[model samples]
Each structure stands twice: as C-alpha cells, then as structure tokens.
Target chain A: MTKNILLSAKGLSKSFGGIKAVNNATIELKSGSITGLIGPNGAGKTTLFNLLANFYTPDRGEVIFASKPIHQLPTHKIARQGMVRTFQVARVLSRLSVLENMLLAPQKQTGENIIKVWLDRKTIKKEEKLNREKAMSILESVGLDSKAKDYAGALSGGQRKLLEIARTLMSDPKLILLDEPAAGVNPTLINQICDHIVNWNKAGISFLIIEHNMDVIMSLCDRIWVLAEGSNLADGTPEEIQNNPHVLEAYLGQ
Target chain B: MLNFIINLSNNSGYIVSLTILTSVFAIFALGLNLQWGFSGLINFGHIAFMTIGAYTTVMLSLSGVPLIVAVIIGAGLAALLGFFIGISTLRLREDYLAIVTIGVSELVRLVANNEEWLTRGVQGVRRYQIPFVDWEPGILGKVIAIALLTGIAIFAQWQLLRGIKNQFKEYRSVQNKSYQPTKPIVCIIWGAIATIVILFIYINGIISLYNYHYQAGLMVLALLILALVYSGLEILVRSPWGRVIKAIREDEEIARALGKNVFFYKLQAFMLGGAIAGVAGSFYAWQLNAVYPTSFEPLQTFNAWIIVVVGGAGNNPGTILGAIIFWTYDAVTRFLLPQLGIDNARLSALRIMVIGLILMILVMWRPQGILGKKEELTLGK
Candidate 1:
C-alpha cells in the first residue's frame, strides 16, 4: 500500500531471561489509517503496544514516530509527541471530577503558573473561564457533558471507557493505540465507542485498536494484522484475513 | 457579689490564657493536620519546624534586630525548614519517609540542645523581644496592640484560607466537602474566631495595662484558642487537595497514571504544611514569652501525631476536638496527678503512659480514629 509513514517499528525483539515475549516482530502504522491487531492471550499484542509506545525499552527495536526516533524517550515524552496509548483497564484520576479528569489530561496548559495563579487572581479567573469553556465543549463531544459534575469513580464501566477516550482526545493525539477498548463494554456502548473511533478516523486521527470482538475487528479496521505466538501471522484486508487459511489455522491452534 | 465578681474576672484571664496557649498548639496541630490529614505526608518531626521558628525569633531578637524583622526571620526559617524537609522526603514512599522524619526531628532537638552558641545549649534563648511590649503604654495602648496583632493574624489567616479555598474550588468534587475558605460559612466561622481572639486580647490588654500585670495574662489567653485554630486546620484538609491526599493514600499509583504528578503535589502540600507547623512553633514561642531548646523536643511533634491518630487519622475536626479534649485533660491531669497518688517525677511519666494507652486502644479497636473514613486506616489486609 502506498502511504505516508507515521510510525514504523523495525526489528522489534524483547525477552525476559530466556523467554522471548516479543521476538523479531515488526509493524508499520501508516498515517490516516485504522489498523487492527488481533491475537489470543500471550500473543504479545499488548506487549508490542507497550514496546511501541516506549513504555518498555525493546531489547532491540527502532520506533520512529512523527519521523523522530522515540525508542529512548520516556513514556510521557512519547505521549507529548502526539502518540499516546490507552490501557486495557481504564485508569481515571478518581479524586478529580469527570470534567477535572478531562482537564488534567491536557497537561499542555500554559497558564497554570503556581505563583501567577495565586498572586494574579484576575488572570486566573479569566483563564479558568476559558479553560472551562474548552473543557465543556470537549466533554460534549464525548457524550459526557451531563456527567461533568460526577466524580470519575462514579462513572459506569462504559462511561469510564469513554472517559479514557476523552482523556486521549484531551491530549489532542495524532495517533492512539487502544489496548482492548471494548473488552468489558456492553454492545450498545461498544457501538458508541466504535462510532467514535470511526468519527475520529474521519477527523484524521489514526488508531491501532486491539479488539476481541470479531464483528468489531472485521467491520472497522481498514487493514488487519494478526499475531500468533509473538509472530505476525498475516497482514491484509479484513476479508482477505478472514479467508486466509493461515489465520484460520492460527485461530484453531495449529 | 464583689468577691465573686473578682474571682470570676481572675478565672476569666486564666481561661483567656488557656485559650491563647491552646490556639498556639491548635495552630501547630492544624499544620500537622494538613500534612497528615490532607496530603498524607508523614511528618514525624513537626516540632523541628516549631523549633526553627522559636529559635529564629529568639536569636534574631537577642541579636538586636527589630521585633518585626525577628518574627519575619522566624517565619522565614520555619518555611526554610519546611522546604528542606519537604524536598528530602516527599519523593519516597510514606513509611520510609515517616521513619526518616521521626529521626530528623530528634536530630533537630539534639542540635538545639547541644548548640550552646546558637540555642544557648539546653537552657535555650530567653529575654527574647516580645511583640508590642515597648508599646504597652496605658490600658488602651496595650489593648490596641493586642487587638492589632490578633486582627492582623486573623486577617492573614482569612486571606490564607481564601487562597486555600480557591485552590479547593478549582477542582472541588463533593457537596459536604466544604473547604475552609472565604465562603460565607467560613466567613462566619472566622468572624467567630476573630471575635474570640479580639475579646481575649482586648480584655487581657485592659487588665494588664491597668494593673501593670501583663505577662501571665498573655499565656492564659493563648491556651484558650486551641480549639478554634485546629478546627480551622481540619476544615482545609477536607478540601479538594485533601481529597487528593486521600486518593493518594488509597492508591497513589492510580493518581500518577491520571497525570497528577503525585510526587510534586505531595511535596507542595508537605512544604505548605511544614511552614504552617513552623508558624505554630513561633506562636508557641510567643505564648511562652521565651524559647528554649528543650521546648521544641521530638515529644511535641510526636504528641501532635498522637493527637491526630487518637482523634482520627484522616479526620481534621476530630483531631482539633482531640486537641482540646486532650490538652484540657492534660492540664487537669498535670495538676491533679501531683495531688493524687503519684510523685512529681512519676506524674510526668503518667501522662506519657496515658497517651500511649490511648493511642494503642485507638489503633487496636478503632484504627480509623473517631471521624476518619474506614479506608484511611491502613492495614496490610
């Protein structure tokens, strides 16, 4: 496929002692594309995601994000470069309210000088107003507008998922890697989440989603990459992947 | 009727003195409360900050610097100590921090005791300049000076509380979680505290200025204010930052993942709290009319912790309440213990024994103390 390269991981291999968790796995995430990574448990799909996001230093790999080599960068530094990831289990700042949860995500706020915040009350009040307006609008986009007053912990499982998505959006991400976005979500909420992914894709934010739902995997992903036992099984269109005998065998424990 | 009136008036001064002294300790407790109650920074060496405040004021005063400058120096030293303590420990985990802190406070006491040149060795610094003493003219002057100090302190506290409230309001979550800020409720409470502080100062000033008996009345009024000061401290910890501390207490790693920079916030809170503890120490110095190295012992810091845990670990109001109840019982016991079956030396030991037993019982049965949330009490389970 002819595409602008957004992130390319070459010769990625990592091991714990004698165990090769992710061995010589390489993948390319092209710009403006929704990609699917599917595999059974222990397939190193999440591990690969971790390595790609710079959470773990790969034993050997080169991660090029936004055309810069980011393998040695810290996780937050990687996130600041517009490549962010969401964990499988939703982690929200439980103390802050839902709105606060969203606001804290966009740590790029420039107006929050502690001295200026305390001393110059007027500037703080004005900044606060503007920040609130922006926060509310973003909350509206994620269907969490009404829950702005709610503590983050009080949100339901699906809402927390939406909150995680909202949090990533607050970072104004160019690319997102979701590790099991629809794992515990109800079907209806899962559809809402899928719709959001599709909408974000339309708005030019690319995603690499690890989804267990076969229907979700087949319908949305522009291209699919299947992994088996820490190795790439196949990479193709969803239809081509579904028809591939190798993918069938991998699923059937061959 | 005249005799009774005279008796009431004498007792009222003692009451006032008690209030002022209590206020000083209450202020110390409040600072400690903010550290323990809001941010969960285990500041075991709280009185070290207090010692800094006391020694600074006394040393500066003895050196012939103006009293205002000395007070400022004292406050500055306290804040400096706070900054140092905060930087050293706020990064590490809680228990390790606590152990180090307990050790650090004792080291401060040891330094204060041994350093004869600085703290006059074990004897401490005396003949320290008192605020508004030269201004203690007629009844009105004394009254005015006391009122001015009280008013200024209450006002500064009012402003400080306002800033804290604004910080709380920035990310406030719950309804009953009322921050002790410039809210109408807080205003009314401050108003009441101001009234009491003013009344104590005004009344004491009148008698002392007229009768030419000043020093003792000041001590009496200082002790009476123990409740108000700590209660105010309790209120701040119930604010949003307080909740953040509790969140940290519950699961700090989660707080970190949410981009809260749990370490930094904890440090800021720790320093602010230490500064407050310093203020308390200074205030105690003021109450005592002289500061000695022996006064800022580790026992004072640990005593505040005992007050916090015995009252309730995470509950602010409970600790304040604990302070008043404990101090009053302490005062009564100090007087009554000597009268009862115990010798004078053993009487001191009894207070320690009683404090230990109370702490032990509270830990064994009601680990969360009186007002704390159950989760605030940590067990390995």
Candidate 2:
C-alpha cells in the first residue's frame, strides 16, 4: 500500500562558528511508517533532528509537517502541530511524580489557564479526573502504573526512556522523533521497546528513530537514512542499505 | 474592654509593633516564594515591586483617591513593571533574568531618589491617608469591635488545639501501620510550639482591645491579608497551572517539547508575584507611617530571601514561620544587644553577623529549610 509523506525537510543547513554541523540534508517520513536515522558520532544526525524540530534554526531550509510549512514556527508550536521529539538522555522532571510527567503533555488544558483554574474549577476538576484516568491507563500499559506516585528521577535508565516515549503519547502526536531510544538501554528492554514502537506504528503513529543498535534498526525500520560528516550518504530499504558500499564505508571509515 | 486594652497596650506596644512588621515581611516573602520557590524565576529585585506599590499608593491617596483603590492601582502598576521586565528577560535564561531584575530594582531606587517632583527626592512622601484612621467608634462600636476580636482569638485557639489532637492521632496511626518504633519527640515539639503560638495570639488580642488605635488595627488587617494570600498561593501551587510552572522550573525544554508555552507561563508567575509584593508594600508603608526612598533597599530584598531560605523555599507555611522567627530575633536583639556593652553601629553589625552564621549552619545541616521535605529538596541541584 502507498502512503503519503507526513513530514519533509528540504535543503536544511546549519553552522556554528564556521563549522557546518548539518549541510544541505533532506529527509522525509511517510505516514504510518517507521524510519531510521543512523550515523557515526558527530555525523550531524542529532543536529538534523534539532533542525527539523526547530530546536535550532536552519540557515536555509523549509520543513513541511502534515502538508504545512513549520520551520518558521517555534519549537513548542511545532510540537503542538502534532510532532514531538525526545532527548537522547531521557529528560524528565525529577521532582514531579511519574503521573504528573504524563499529565503535562496534553495540549489545550483548561486548568493550565490561571483564571480558569479559579473561575471554572468544576470543569477543571472534571478534566483533571479524566486526564488522571487516561494517564493511569497509559502507565499500566508500560507497566509503570505501580510507580506512578514515585518521582521520575527514581526510575531506572530504561524505564526513563519508556516514560519519555509514553509521555509523547499523551500529547496525541502524529509523528515522534526519538533520539537513541535503544542507546544505553539493556538488550531485553530494547526488544520490548521495539515491539511497543511497532505496535504504536500499527495504530497509525509515525516514528523517526536514531539508534546505534543495527539489529534493532534493521528489524524495525521500513526505510533507513544514513548521514556521514554532515551529509546524507544513503537512503534505502534496510537490506539495500546493508549491501550499499557507501553506507558500509561511512561506518567502517576508509 | 477599651480601658482594659489601653492599660495592657501601655506595656506591650513594642511587641504589637514588632508583630506588624513581621506580618508585612511575611507577605513580602510570600510573593518571593511564588516566584522563586515554585516557578524558579530567580527574582533578586523583588523589592522594586514593593517600592512601586508604596509610592503609588501613597501618592494616589494624598491626591484624594480612595485608599483601597490606590492600593489596587499600586499592585497593578507593579504587575506592569513585571510585564516589561519579563518580556525582555524571560525568553533568555535564568541567570540573565537575575542580573536584569537586580539592576532594575537599583534603577527603581535611583529614580525614586532623583525624581524630586514626583517622589519629593530623599525627603520622602509623608502624611498619606492611613486606612481606618479617622473612625471614632462610640461605646457600642467599641463593644462590637472588641467582641469580634475576642471571637477571632477564640477561634484561633480552638484550631490550634484541634491540630494538636490530630497530630497525636496520626502519630499513633503511623506506628500502628508501619510497626516501627517511631519517636514522639517531633510531635511533642510541634505541640509545644503551637501552645506558645496560641498564648502569644491571646496576649495580642487582649492588648489590642485596650489599645484600639490605628497601628493595632493595621496589625489585624495585615495578618488577615497574609492568611488570605498564603491560602490562595497554597491552592494555586497544587493546580495544573502550577504543575506547568513546576515543570518549567525543573526542565523547560521538556515543558516546551510537551507543547507548553514556557515563556508565557514564566511571565505570568513574574507578574503575579510582583503584584503580591506590591500589596505587601502598601502594608509596609502603613506600618512605617511614611514612604521613603531609602526604605526600599537592596538589603530589604535579601531580608525576604533570608526568610524564604530559612523557612523553606517551596513551602508557604515555612515562609511565614521563617518571618516570625526572624522578626522575633530582631526584636529580642534590639533590646538585648544594647545591654551587652556594644555600641549602636557594632550592635547592628553583630546582629547581621549572627544571622549570617545561622544561615550558614542551616545551609549545611537543614538545607531544605525547617518545613521542606528531604526528598523534594532541589536547592543547588
């Protein structure tokens, strides 16, 4: 079955003090598909994610999300536009409870408005009850329901990654940019995450993942994009990329 | 009742005045708590709002506006100042906000000092309208006012007793559930403190019935305002709006990634906190009986910080407790230090040194402040 493009970045470039971090890199994500971004250290893979999400502005580029140009928008605005990204180190509010971390992700919260917090308390309370129930169910799915009352800081490294991904689900995103979801995570947990991602993809959520685990990437990604030294080296099916000489050379070095 | 209060006031006027000062500073530090404790805005120039509120309210009252309306306007103007400062610095970084706020407060003080036509220069503004100053209550009015004061005193005592009872109940319940040999020392300490506080309030209430003057009335009003503000803030910090700000404080990037407008929320906390401090400034001006340029000093801002740090940054009750303890120290030292053979200048310096020592010890041992939770302490982290 054919799928339409969900996100497209054209001619993206960024430089810091005369060093081009991401040079003329272009990538696309199809709706209802899992895409992989793979590169060696300092190959500008993370920089590309930052640019696409508007964490860092590109000197020359236009990004279209769901058929709308979002490069000019703020990072929060882009996330509100149904695209969210996660950090490589799995950032969580250490002081907040695990349930609160999930509760913070929903957009257009009535209780977030200061005046409504006091004036329309009944509605806010109802909304809070609904959000809490939803958060609990999501936590239960990830087996984090038992630790909902615990601080996010107390979670294991792998659990923190899962929490971060689960938090994005609360925002109802169409596309999620996950930065190294499998990095530093134990092998058993990595497979568990891969399964969750495939299930989420089947439920119509698109993903762009960066991973050092080649087995996880090749098995999960429908298509792959390779970056080397701030430029795109190859883009193809996993089997094609595995056979491509340029992709092998970029990883092994000449 | 009036005669009884007047006689009692003859001996305890100093304590009554000190309580007024503590209450005003508590209100001031509460505003700082909302900004720094909960939102993590790093507002070092909190006194600027106080200065604006005092000057604006006094100037407006002198020009014939109603006292309450003048105070409201003062708070509004302070919030406006917050808006300007927040727009410029909130989008940048916390350290930048700190530098800008400190500089802006200094700028505000300088303007008050130089703008002779507006602020009357260093001489300061005097003889503004004091709230409830002109009322000459007859016999019936005095009886009603005394009765009201007595009723409030009784109510406060009842609450304290009930609180003590509840604490004991919970203590036993915890032991039953956990089966641990938990010590009762903390509970006993709390009960003793509550008893002392109850006795203090009763003494003040009895004295105020005789005094019945503007200053005594101001103390009651100030305490009432402090209670209201504290309760309001308590509710706010537990709300979803507060959750967003707490999130912003810990990691704004995560908040932004979750689609929250981080800059907007920071600006809101800044303006609201400034507005609260402005209200505190009005109470301060009333207590001082004059609004002076030197009154709003950089040192005054640090006084609020000391109260917040000593009490607990994120806890409202802790801020109030800090203010009470701090002012009690000031009052005690004022009389005692002079008797210790030290000159006025040295005595003042020594007082500050002692406070500094206490602060250092508290930082090392009880870094979360007296009332703060051990696990939730985020200082320096």
Candidate 3:
C-alpha cells in the first residue's frame, strides 16, 4: 500500500443529461501493482476508466500520470505519456491480420508518416522488422503466434481478449487499464489471462483491471476498490473487501 | 484479310483514346481506394479534387507557367483542399465526410461553371499544351519510351513479388511443408508475356496506327503515370503507415487508444488521395484536349466509386480491370444502341440502367467485388 503512485484521479465527475454517471470518483494505481476495480453493472466503473484515460472529459477532475497533469491531454496524448486502456469489448481491427493489429499498436513508427513511409524506406523497413519481431514474441507469449497471419475477425472471443492484452505490450506502457478482461471469456482462458497479468505485473508493468468475475479479482488483485452508484463504496485487500458490509449491501441491492 | 487489317488500323486511334480514358479513370479509382478502401474515409465529393486538379493545371499553363509546374501546383492545391476538408470533418463520424465532400464538390462545380474570368465559365478551357506535345517521337523514340516504361513496370512487379514472398515466407512455409515456386514462376511468366506484347506492338509499327499524331505520346504518358501511382500506392498500403490507416478505418477509438493520432492519419490519407486524383485530372484534361466545368460533375465521382466497387474496393488490380470493363461496356453500348435505332438521350439513360443492373447483381452476389478479399471489408454485419 506504500508504493509510488503511477496514476491517480482526483474529484472526477461526468454527467449525461440529468444523470451523474460518475460523481466525485477518485482512484489511484500504484506502480507495479495489480489493482482491481469492481462494481455491479452501471455502477460507473467504465465511466471512471474513461475519465482516467481521458476518453471522456470529466466535468471537474484532474488526472496525473507520472506526476504530470493529464486531464487536459487527449486520449492519444495520455497514451503516449505511458498509460493505455483497453475496451470492455476488445476493439481489434477485425479486417486486418492479427499481426497487423499488433504492428499497429507501437507508437512513433517512422512509417506512420506518409512522407516518411516513402522517403525513409530503409529506416521504416528496419523499424518494421524490429517491430514484427517484437510483435511475434509477444504473440508467442499469448499463444497467438500461429494466428499471426489469420484475420483477427477469425479469432474466438477469448483469443481476441488475449490479443487485446498482447497488443498493449507493443506500446511498452508503464500502466494499462483493462476494462472487464474476464467478461465473456472461457474459464480456462480466464485463468490464463490472470496468469499473464501476474507475469506482466512481475515484469514491472502495473495494471488496473476491471472484472465482473470475483474469482479473477480475488486471485490477481493486490488491492481492490469497489464502486457503488458512481461513488466509492470500499477499498481494501480482497479479504477485507469480501467482509465489507457496505460492499455486500450494495451488490445485494443491485 | 487486308480490308480487316486496314479497318483495325483505322479505328486504332479510337482504341488508343478509349484506353487513355480508362487508364485515367483507373487512376481516379486508385485515389478512391486510398481514401475509402484502405482508410475508410467517405469522400462522395471526390470529383471536386479532380476538378481542382484539371482546372488549376489548365489555368496555370495557359497563363504562361511551365507545364510541369502547373501540374504540380494543381495537385498541391487539391491536396491542400483535402487537408482542410479532412481537418473539418474527419473528427466527426464517417458519414460527415461524405456529406461535406459532396457539398464541397458541388460548390466547386458551381464556382467553375459561373466564374468566367478564371475558368472561362461554360465556354471551358481548351487546347492547353500537354507535356511532350511539341516533340513528335519517331518509331524508334516511341519504342524506346515504351521499353523504358515497360521495364519499370516489370521491375516494380518483381519487387512487389519479392516483398510479398519475404514477408510471408515463414507463414507460407509453415502452412505448406514444401516450399513451392508457384508465385515467382507465375510472376516471371506474366512479366515475360508483357515484355513480348510490348515488343510486338512497337516492332510492328502499331504505334503509328493512331490517327492523332499526339496519341502515342499521350498514351505513353498516361501509362507511365498509372504505373507510378499504382506502384506507389501498393508500397504505401503494404507499409506500416498503411496498417495504421486500416486500423483507423476499423476503429478510430482503438487507434487512438494505441497512441496513434487518428485525425492525422485520416488527413494524410485524404490529402494523398486528393493528390492522386489531381494527377488523374491533368491526364483527363489532356485526354479530352479540354477542361469543362460539366466534366467534373457528380457523375464522375460515382463512376470512380462504381469502378472501385466493381473491381474490389481495396484491390488496385481489380480497380484497373473495373475501369477497363466499365469503359468497354460504355463504348460497346454507345455503338450498339445507336445501330439498334435508339436516340442519343434514351441510349444514355439505357446505358446507365445497364450499369445499374450490373452493379445490383454484383452487390447481391459478390459485394466484396471481383478481386476484393472478403475478410478485408469492415462491414457492420
């Protein structure tokens, strides 16, 4: 609990019409820790993730990543600042090959520029070779190396989920906010995903994971934060959170 | 046999003209491919770019600017317009681009139609000097140019094949336990056939058969431009830049999440497509020997779209084939319908109807198009 803060959101709030989706929600992700965010459906967990990642601008909040104010930064700018997020439904480019999806995730690719792609052909090709090697190694780790040439649309739901996580490795981010990584995934893959998360955490990549599945949260999360009705309900270790009365009441009420 | 040969040679000028037209449209559709096919940017006003290109080139050249400078400026202007349009609309949903582009295109047409001082109004611009118009190439000169262009085309094809083989070598080897030389062999055979055809055509003095003295030079120019644009697009589409554009097309949010500036890539694609269209516009103006406000009508945009759709949205070879098919149908129907006693107005309508029917059938049975890969289409369904 005494770890250095990697990312933190303060006094974040957003509203749609008359409804306050996320109100005064504050959260912190410690460096090299696997944090879990849990709530019932429509508890504004995703909304909070959006705010933290700058996908949605908060009405009144400040996000600091690596001690730099990032609330004003765009989503891509925030990502470049060493924090990235994945969707609840894995948003892979289905038309592209699995390897293409991986290759697209890296930042600052020289070939990303139209002029550079033509003018800097040698540099681009060299960089691409290096990127492909990195992507293949990452795909190997996720057991998707064989499907590198396959269209991503051909992937199963679990494999797409695995690919989503694998893609984040290409960016070499300090923190990754995963939105419902275990949702709709098969049990075996769920275990595998948790194992990968643990391994990634051990390798110095911090994670803030949102999961409806309590088993994944209990096993993988170092500490858990519970949201109820767009506000913080409880925060503690998995054991303490399980016994928290308000957390139990909120889930029961839902 | 002698009469038949004479007749074929007599109509060869018309054939060359038709070929030039088809190649110009192929270039147009290639631009569309970069925008809609690869980047998923909807540009219903693509004709606007073509208009900007053609008019700018003609206007500049007529005002005493060098032909090459005029063409470069024309393309640059079109690209600048594309950049502005992209900045204004790319941040919104995809349909906004379609709407804005169509409106802008119509606005450009109207401006060209009414502006007498700049564009000469409805009278249109005519007889601007095309590149190499003064230099009447002899048979030997023509053959040399043809050979040089063909050599570039073949080298481009070989490089493409080698790149594909290198990129997918591991996957292919893994999929098929034995490595087959099928792809390279096929490519080499095709290259050889192309070389023989070029040599045969040039050696037999077929190039002299065109009635118009400028026809050979213009055709060669068009072919050279087409080859350069096609190869350029092929390289870009296979590069890392292309992957990012495809990713943006698939899901802008995901691309942004991965730290890519989605707007930036979209703008780049739009501008590049516009620049290519501008180049096509210059060729088009030369083909007709005129630049009319009516020529850049909305129908022109639809023609390019139809070509792209029929050929294979993302497939460049399919686009070229689609252009050839479309123009051949148009030419054949024009002659046949008149011979069958149809008036000009009715024949035109009927021609459109036939195209519509063909498109309908294609959509129903093969929406991915003649050469399009099914997996590449990002259809919602």
Candidate 4:
C-alpha cells in the first residue's frame, strides 16, 4: 500500500572539516506512520535529522515538508510548518518550569510581540490561560501534571525525555523527529514512551525516530531504514530489514 | 536632637546630591538587569549606551531640539546601536558579546573624546538646561514638595507590596498549608516601618528644606524617572515576552528548537536595555550639568555591574538596593577617609580597596546576590 509522504529528503549531504558526516542520504516520512531510522555509531543518522529539520544547511540536495521546499527556511519556520525535532539529550530548559517548557512550544503567540504583550493584556491573558490548560492536559496525559511547577532540570532523565515529547505535542506537530527517545531511559519508561508513540501514531501524527534500542525499533516501526557510512543502506518492513544480509553486514562491520 | 537635626539639614544639599547620584546608577543597573539578569546577555560595555544617551540629549537640546524629543532620540539612537550590535554578535557564543560590547564602549568613548566638532571633546558640554527649569519652587516650597513626594513614594511602596501579595496569594496559601506565613507579610511590615520613619523625620523637623529646593526638585525628578522605568521593566519582565527572553537565556538552542526567534528576542532585549541606559544617561547629565568623554569610563560600566551583582542579578528591588549600598559606601568612604587624614591618592586607593573587599565578600558569601533566588542565577548548580 502506498502512503502519502509527510516529509521527504533527497540527496542530502553535509560535511565537517573534510569529514562527510552525512553523504547523499535520502529518506521519507509517510503520514500517520511510525518510521524508524537505524544506524551503527557515526552512521550519520543525526546529521540526516539535522538536515531534514533545517538545523544545518545541506551542502547538496533538498527537503520537502507538507509539499513545500523547506531547505531555505529557518529551523523554527520548519517547526511552525508542523515539523518539530527533539534532541537526543532532551533539551528542556532546565531553569524553566515544566509547564513553561510546554508553553514555549506553541508558535505565533500574540504575547511574544513586545507591543501586544503590553497593550493586548486581555487577549494575551486569555491566550495564556488557554495554552496553560492545553499544557496541563498534555502533562496529565503523560503523568507529569503534578510536576508541572517543578523546574525541568529537576526531572529525572527519563522524565525529561517524556517532557520533551510532551512539549512537542504542544505545537500540534504533524511530524515529530525524535532523536533517541528511549536512550538511557529505564525499561518501564521506555515501555511507556513506546506506548505513547503508538497511541500518538494511531491518533494521526507521524514519527521519524532515530533509536539504537532494537526492541523499540522492531516493535514500533511500520518500516525501517538503515544508514551506514553517511549513506543509505536499505529500507524495508521490520522483518525484511531484520533478515536483510546487507543490514546485518552493516551492523557486524560496526 | 535639635542641634543634630539642624546640622543634618545644613547638609541637605549634599544628602540630596548623593541620593540623586544613587538614583542615576540605579537606573543604569536596572537596564543591566534586564539584559544580563533576565536575558543573560553579557554586555560588558553598557556605559556606551549612557555615553551616547548623554551626549545626544545634550547636543540635540543645545542645537534647539525640544528637551523631551531630544531625550527620546538619544534613547532611540542607543537602542539602534544595540540592535545593530546584537545582530552582528548575538548568533555567536556568549563571550563574543562581552568582547564586542567592551570594545564598542571604548570606541564610543574615544569618538566622543576626539570628535570635538560633535561632543566638544575634553572640555565637555556644560550648563545644559534641565527639564522643569522654569518651575523652580523656592527653598521652603521645595522642602515641602520633597516631603510630600517622599510620602507618596512610601505609599506607593506600600501599595506595590500589597499588589505583590495579592498576586502571590495562591502561593502564599499553599505555603501556609505547609505552616509558613506569607512572605509578603514581612514586606508589608517593612513598608509600614518605612512609612513611620519618614513621618518621624517630618515631625521632628530634623532636616530643614531651606536653600535646597533645587536639589529637592532634581531628587523628585529622579524618583519619578526611577518609578517609571522600574515599573515598566517590572511589567515587561513578567510578561510572556519576558518569559521568552528567560528561556533564551536558559538555553538559546532549546528556545530556537521550540520555534522561538532567538535572535530577534535577544536583539529586542539588548535594545530595550540600551534604551533604559540612555534614559539613565539623560538624568545623569542633568545631575552633572555636563557631558564629558572622561565621565563614561569603563569603571562606570563596572560600577553598574557591581550594583547588579551585589543587589542580586535578576531581582529588580535588589538592583535598587545595590545602587544605594554602592553609592553610600562611596560617599561614606570619601568623607571618612578625608577625616581620617588620608591624602588624596591614598584615599582613592583605599576607597577602591574597600569596594573590592566588599565585592569579594559578597561573591563568596552570597554569589546569587542579596536578593537573588538560587534558581534564577545563570550558573545554577
């Protein structure tokens, strides 16, 4: 069955000081699908993610999101177009409260403007109340509603990852590029994260995840793409990729 | 007691002058707080904004621009410079901003020092007209006016505490459930005590208002400007825009990832801070009745930084307290050193040594500052 592509990257390449971090990497995220990108260490999975999100400009090739070219847009602009990315280390603002971290996700807030922040107090307050409600509800869903007022830095490593995922939901993102959501997380929270991802996918959001936990990638991914040495190796159904000799060799070589 | 009152009143001019100077530095420190305290932008050359503000206001007004218009333009020009500087440097690492700002400040001072055609060079621009010059009330009238203004200020302080208490009512209730009285209760008590002290001073007639009305008027003007700028900043830092800046300060990369225009926000903060410094500069020029390139040394910028650090970075009230503490220490040291028979050069060195000692102690004992919250510091543990 064919699925509509929510995001696609073609011929993306990036280099740092004579080292090709990512070379001619091509991938796509289909709508309402949980796609997995797996690679050995230094296989350029994160570089690909950076290029797709416009965090780094590609030396070659282009990215299209929601049927528009996005290579020229800023990372935030790409995010505003319903594509959001999370860091592997869970980059929550450590000093901000959990709820504030959530509130920071929404785009185009009227209160973000200097003049409107002063003059449109009524509207800004109303919008803030609504955003707070939204953040709280999302936090409740993730079992973090009680810790909403706590500084994000105080959260356990697993909780910080959960908070990052929860924060992305605040933007009402159509596609989420999650970099290692399960890395360093305990087993129980990892299970919880997988369940949340599945539920979110069922509810119509697409995910492009870079993860090393084979169990997570195997169980959650509808399709899996493998990268080796800064280039695409193979992409297929989880079972097909599991049996593919080339994919096996890439892992063995690493 | 009467003799003491009479003696103090005889020196009212000196007291008022000291207060006016403190108020000016307080305004400068407040601007620094907005940038370094809230936004975590390291502006090492903040004095440049003050220099531009002072020079522009004086030059423009001298060339026949209206006083108010000139002041606004001066602030606007400072803000414009800040905007450009932020654009060129905000994207880089934090230390770059510090280096650039310090360099920029030196460059501005040098320009003012050499550009005789513009700034009048070493001689400085003196005898510039201050606002409300035509409305000078006589000595007795000025005294009464200052007393009234002090009363109003105390009342305003009380009201401000009450408003803060109301805003934190929920948190106080939560804290009460945990067996703590509301913190604002202490604040209210302090406000009450302050009001009573002012009343005591008025009833005792300890300080005569005679021959000091002009100074009193300047004091009132300084207070008014402080109230305006402080309130504006208070409102701003509490707004969503303020939150964004705080987030940027915490981590610009995360802020950008969350779709905030980090550059834009940083630039805005830089400019607003510069504009505030510019306002302080105008008041400073009024206090000195002159603008000289030498007056804007890097030491003045360090003084503002010390005020912010000692009062507590990120705490507005702390900034004011820091300014008062700083200027009082300065005045007291100057007076005491002379009385102690310290020669001029030695006296200056001793004064600096005392300030340095105080700063060292403060940094060691209360690095977060006198009023700063632990979590609010950029270097949170």
Per-model C-alpha lDDT, please?
A: 0.70, 0.87, 0.85, 0.85
Better of 2 and 3 by lDDT: 2
With candidate 1 superimposed using the best TM-score fit, by how many Å does residue A35's alpha carbon deviate from the native? 3.3
- Candidate 2: where are CA atoms >4 Å away? A1-3, B1-10, B138-188, B191-195, B378-381
Q: Of the candidates shown, which would achieve the greatest lDDT relative to the real structure?
A: 2
Q: Candidate 3: list runs displaced more than 4 Å.
A: A1-3, B1-8, B138-140, B152-206, B209-212, B378-381
A14-89 per-residue lDDT for model 2 (tens digits)? 9999999999998988999999999989999999999999999999989999989999998889889999999988
lDDT of 3: 0.85
Model 1: DockQ vs. true structure: 0.26
**Candidate 4 clash pair list:** none
What is candidate 2's local distance difference test score?
0.87
CAPRI accuracy category, model 2: acceptable
Q: Is the docking of candidate 1 incorrect, acceptable, medium or high quality?
A: acceptable
lDDT for position A28 in model 4: 82
Interface RMSD after interface superposition, each candidate: 6.9, 4.0, 4.3, 3.6
The local lDDT score (0 to 100) that residue A211 gets in candidate 3 is 94
Q: Which stretches of candidate 1 lie over 4 Å from their true place?
A: A1-6, A10-20, A23-27, A49-62, A68-74, A77-79, A110-112, A133-150, A226-234, A243-251, B1-8, B65-91, B137-262, B289-293, B307-326, B332-381
- Deviation (Å) of A242 in candidate 1: 3.4
Worst 10 residues of 4 chain B by lDDT: B173-182
Of the two candidates 1 and 4, the one with more favorable DockQ, higher being better, is 4
Q: Please, what are the lDDT tens digits per residue for candidate 1 over residues B54-160?
A: 77777887789886677667767777776776678777778978887788788888888898877888776777776545544666755654565455456545644
lDDT of 4 by residue, B84-182 (tens): 889999999989999999999999999999989999999999877787556656657666666766665675566556655663674554452212333
Specify the poorest-scoring 10-residue window by lDDT in model 1 chain A: A109-118
lDDT of 4 by residue, A1-254 (tens): 24488888899999999999999999987898999999999999998988988889999999988889999998778889998899988888887778899998888888899888778889989999999999999899899998887778778889999999999999999999999999999999999999999998898999999999999999999999999999999999999999999998889864
